[model samples]
Target: MPDCIICHLEITDPNNLFECPNNHPVHKECLIEWLQHSPNCPLCNEPYSLETKSNLKSDLDKREEEKKKSEEDEARKERNNQIKIIAEKIIFLKFLNMIETLIEKKDFEGALDRLNSIDENKLETVKK
Candidate 1:
């Protein structure tokens, strides 16, 4: 039985086909209708164009590289943020110790002067 040129559907009366050496029947009406201008098969995947393969591979590689770079950037930013938080804590503790020493020496004025230079959260350390 003759089949469609593109999809291999059974050829009806209005449809006619030409035989290809690959044994896949191709309808004349279907040939004119579809797959003639197109490159790939409708059902079975077969490489019809070399340029399509090349472009697809190149595009995929670029996308993968971009994804990797994005992940690395996120990791780096997290590490930097962690380091900054630790440094801020260390600086706050040192400032608090200095304020405690000043206040113990009955240098409340000096300590208050330092407190005025510092922010409220830093002053909260002395209050604690």
Candidate 2:
């Protein structure tokens, strides 16, 4: 059994085997990953054919697009969370200001009523 030079693992599947111009064998998956870093073979330093490089380049491009999309999604979620937190804080501050105005007017009953109507869950989110 021939071993893939890139992974030092046995080429279990003949269909998954790839060879460089010098006939150095490597796993197709490993070579695809390796191509991202270099265009040359790991063993012989020979460049892969244009067709092989083009196919591998296409695969690498798809992987990069997927990675970028995933990162963008994560960033958008983080931004939304930050926006939500800011909105909550703004609401909480407005609620506090209203209470303060009531206290200044000697309207203790109104302030107490407003405090009672406060949503505890929303207050907890602001606290965090």
Candidate 3:
């Protein structure tokens, strides 16, 4: 197997290999990375075609867009989780206020029932 000129590593996967116009071998990923900075073959210094550069740029742009999209998705999910936590806190506080009101009215039994209905396990899990 031919070794990649850029990484100096053996090209084992056929799909991960590429060749320059001068028949110089390189890894597809390595060539793409190198093409971002330079347009010549690393081994022979042969000038690459405009088509090759354009294709590489398109691939790189696509990857960048995908990465940005993934990051945005993660951020949205995190925001949703935070919103859920805030909403739960609001509900918990409302329940506490109700219990407090019951206590102030001297309704101990109603306050106890409301307190007992809260899931202590869920509360502990959320705290941690």
Candidate 4:
């Protein structure tokens, strides 16, 4: 059994193994992490082929795109929440203005009716 250059451990797991073009074997996980930093073999310092390098770039690019997409989704959700909060505030302010106008007109009964129609649960949902 040959030792993995990255981990300095003997490669025991056949399934978790990889080999360079020069036939030098290393742990699969170690080689992948190493490839992220450098394109050369860890022990022999032999550079990987264009095909291998291209594949690595593709994988990295895919991961970056996914990260950006996730971030955009989170930002969109936050913006929507903010918009909802502002809308709720606008609604509350409009209702208050209506109640004030009713009071000014001495329509206490109409103001009380509007106040009673407001749902407490809806207010709690807007707070969150």
- Model 4 per-residue lDDT tens digits across residues 36-104: 677899778898777765756766566667778999999999999899889988877788899999999
Candidate 1 per-residue C-alpha lDDT over 1-128 given as tens digits, one digit per residue, 9 for 90 to 100: 76664775887763354443344555654443333345454444443345433434554456567778999999999999888777777888898899999999999999999978987775555444
lDDT of 4 at 79: 100
Q: Order the candidates by TM-score, highest first — what do you get? A: 2, 3, 4, 1
Expressed as tens digits, the lDDT of each residue in 49-77 for candidate 3 is 77766757877677668878999999999
Model 3 C-alpha lDDT versus the unseen true structure: 0.82
TM-score, one value per model: 0.46, 0.70, 0.66, 0.60
Residue 45 of model 1 has an lDDT of 40
Q: What is the lDDT of candidate 1?
A: 0.63
* lDDT values, one for every candidate: 0.63, 0.88, 0.82, 0.81
Of models 1 and 4, which has the larger lDDT? Answer: 4
- RMSD after Cα superposition, model 4: 5.3
The best candidate by TM-score is 2
Pairs in steric clash, model 4: none
Tell me the deviation in Å of residue 48 in model 4.
10
lDDT of 4 at 40: 90
Question: In candidate 2, how many Å is residue 55 off?
Answer: 3.2
Candidate 2, after superposition: displacement of residue 63 in Å? 0.7
